[model samples]
Target: MIFDKLKKFDIVFDSPEMDCPPVFSSGDVVSGKVVLELSAESKVESLKLHAEGFAKVHWTESRSAGSSTAYTQNYSDEVEYLNRREVLLQADNGELTVLSAGRHEYPFSFQLPEETLVTSFEGKHGSIRYWVKVKLHRPWATVKKIKKEFTVIEPIDINTPSLLAPQAGTKEKMARTWYRSCGQVSITAKIDRKGYTPGEVIPVFAEFDNSTSRSVVPKAYITQTQTFIARGTMKQKRAVVATLCGDIVGGNRRETWHGRAIKIPPVGPSILQCRIIKVEYMLRVCVDVPGTSKLSLEFPLVMGTIPLHPFGSRTSSVSSQYSVNIEWLRMAIPEQPEPPPDYSSVVSEEEAVQNSTEVQPEEDLSGVLQRSLMAYVQEFRLRPPPVYSEVDPNPQPFAMRPRCMTC
Candidate 1:
């Protein structure tokens, strides 16, 4: 049985054997079974063990100072993108056992903090590292420790400094912009039809250069503020060239706001307001800004509107195609609603009544008065009129006629 005396013990890891997920987002438990297999010819006093988890972040920034002819350089960490440390687990002496001869497997498991698993790692630079280490304590000069790179990833914790005022003085202040596209934005707009059939929705679309330092949150509006004479009836439609009520489609924010940062990364080259309702005879995009001047966007705006539909139904029935370019320049008009039109000047009740009576010809005085009474009759429409196109004479003219003419 001297072979039993040759038995010695060793520890091994399984979860992060090669590479591990730094933070296991799954609420499910993360565990590892440590197999304590004994050698055939080894004797062991006791197996004392512990597992420790660690995480860290790191980054570097380089700067250059220049002179008239030459420039010196310096290097340091970018303070804006700094790193932090977090302890994942510490299972100290969690497992200890006196060994019996031959080979055996011991399974060990541990639970990480609930909040730590779901905690965010946005916007932070450096690397997130994790691993499990086991130690074998003995009656010797040193304790053996085994370490491995279980997981590595960039932390998601990104943050920007808060400010009370807009950063306007210098580029350095505006450096808060995370990502900037060095390309130009292009825009092209068009209407679906060349001419409009009155009261019809005109489809408009804008294709533009999406390259920008900021993400585009685009809106559209239309207005009939300008008038073009119509061949038929003059019913015009107007809208604000830009409106924020539409949906955001085709693009995303360059950086997500994790609620921890004051400003988010810029995003752009997006397409918005593609719905039919957002379409109009003319269309324009109005960019909204938080701190930066929205006007800075070089607006080569493309505008077109749908043609009016033929006048028959309250709803537009015929659709004609129309296209026209509109120029949008800043104006100083009072931004208040235009006062309601002066109804007193446009129409009067007495004129309306006089026009109605004269338009219908009647043959007799009784017939002339009957038209007025029939207009108010509830069931008159269903019943046929007693007579049509009857003529009427003025009472004054009848009075002036001689007795012979009357006879």
Candidate 2:
């Protein structure tokens, strides 16, 4: 209990108005307070607080040479965007000799750099993190410290004309066995545009022609590719964010898909601003054929903060049919007829009379019986009556017993 009481320290942000997973961009001021509660007067040296935002990448590899010579190589990279240190209290300043046995609060603030910074990301090889740390210095004991981490997001806007332009790609591949043509699979996939925001749906149009002898399944997905470069060595990672698998296509048949959309998720935008990390998005469609190699095509995509305007708002001179083929396909897909009326809605007069007879009027016991039941319940109430008892207004104090005999 004594040690638990002596180790009390807390750091809290002053921006209560910010939502959970507090968000901030460049050029924002972050302020917070550090609180220390001492069970006894113990602190002697100084108190320091640090605020820092940085990205660090560390990876190691082992390389072996011929005949018993081996070496380990380590790669480390760090970028510090914000670093601020504040001395809250110091013994050399002669402000106070010893910390009192009470609570103390120190306020600190720092302005983030106006330059763009990478968003906070935690990957296997690297991480971009921002944190606030507080340290309590003592004479003979180890330093006591506390730290808190927060998130930093850099906004990427997609409102530019270049990002809003439509992106499309088509690829064709042939399969053969022993110099004889087995079949050819041709796939053409297109998106309304490259730019997209989180929660925004990406409309995909695909036409697959499978002239092969084997059955093929068409699959489409959005992938986030991250490229990390360190010391002239480049590493790449890819994650599929969304996918759509179409119906199987038989041999010598064409399958057209329209109105297929993949919604974007809350992922980091393209890492064009970061020097060592590069993030890119792609819309990939692959044809998986049984007993044969798969044919795939990828179209680059852009994820941004703003969603594209409606197709009608686009002022480009491109023909409407070329820009949005789904609108045309909507007219081609057969529409279902209106649903028939429900049985309850189409009740005949005789059926109505029968239903009325089944629903007899319910009895209303809302009069004297309800009153009597309520009265009976009130009489058996669990609460004591609020009657006043005569007692002395002035009372003498009594001696309290000790919690333990030793006390």
Candidate 3:
């Protein structure tokens, strides 16, 4: 039988000269060879190949229908980044081609599309994937098919002006009881920079104050947010990627973190070049109290393929003319791990802290905290027009010459 004669069929990629795992990016040429080994002769009509890259998101959420009945809502969307096809071998006029071969190799190459592509990622509800497939057609036998997947990485440097800027936020929440208030909880947190690569350490400094009757614990988390949009609606999923916990603070006590370290785990680079689906990261510092809702301060984070340059290497903010190192482009983008651990697992009694001050009304408190989150970032849209006194502070009392009568 043909199965006995056909020993092996496989595809292999050509290694780069640099030997850094032969990573690929947009507009790259991917060259590889298909190896076929057989002990006897074989006949085939054609061998063809197909390559494609795409991102897709799908998930179902449950909602109430009645007291016990529930209905499901599905959200799904997809984007195609590349598609290409090739014919490796074929009979000139659809005739079966005979091959008496012990070892055969068919080389192939593909030019990835120049369009922007999101890095390879695997998440709970979606994934960005790239792959190539091959088919071998025979006259009177079943067609043989094989597939292989590849990684696509888009470099993101951390030395840019926005990413290099420090991030900080402050939020306060009241600790209330049924009859009276138990004081308040507040948290102020800051990070040195926003952009980072996998395995890099984030330096988090924060102050936590607890005036509530209940003990408070301080915890930090690196979270991944996956957003999927369809039919004018959106669904989101958040997973905890990394976590840090601090000791408990009793009532009327405070705790300070001096550069508390949180190391980032292996994760895919940010996906900003795609539509319909977005992958984002953030740092959440929370103070867990005994009875009330946990108070949290959130700061956005950017995950990138390239690390920040060494200290003193960058004299100023990254300019448009700035270029990334070639070595970084050659490194493979990390594959995002399948759904991280649950967020509830990180909560512990010994790891809560809260800092609070007298603040009335929820909306006003949120506005004040958001306004105080970053001194450097200004959102004029969220802020009303500047308040000015009716009378000018410095009156420009220049005596204009009386010219109305003469004109």
Could you tell me the lDDT of residue 226 within candidate 3?
58
Instruction: Provide the TM-score for each candidate, comma-separated.
Output: 0.27, 0.69, 0.72
- Computed on alpha carbons, the lDDT of every model, listed in order, comes to 0.27, 0.59, 0.65
lDDT of 1 by residue, 1-407 (tens): 32234343343444433442232332334455444444533333243344333322232334455654554332212111112222222335644334555666555545444333211111122112334555544333255444443321111210111211111110111212435333333333332222222222323233323344544544333321211111221211122322222233233222111111010001000111211011122233333332332312112211212212244222222334321101100111122233212212212344324423221111221221122111000000011111211122332232243322201
Residues 1-407, model 2: lDDT tens digits: 22344656898887545433345669988887888887877645778989898777777778899989999988777778889899887867664447778887888888888999777665555667789998877766677889997656676656677776666667788877677778788887666566765445565566789898877888776665555567766555444555666789888987766536555544455666776666677777788654445566777887654344444323221221211122111111112133222222222335334433322122221211122111000001012212222222432221132222111
> Model 2: what TM-score?
0.69
Give lDDT: candidate 2, residue 373.
10
| lDDT of candidate 3 over 28-122, digit per residue (tens) | 99999887888889887888989988888787778898899999988788888888999998978988888786988999998887866677765
Q: Can you list the residue pairs that collide in candidate 2?
A: none
- Model 3 TM-score is 0.72
Candidate 3: what lDDT?
0.65
Model 3, 375: alpha-carbon shift in Å? 34
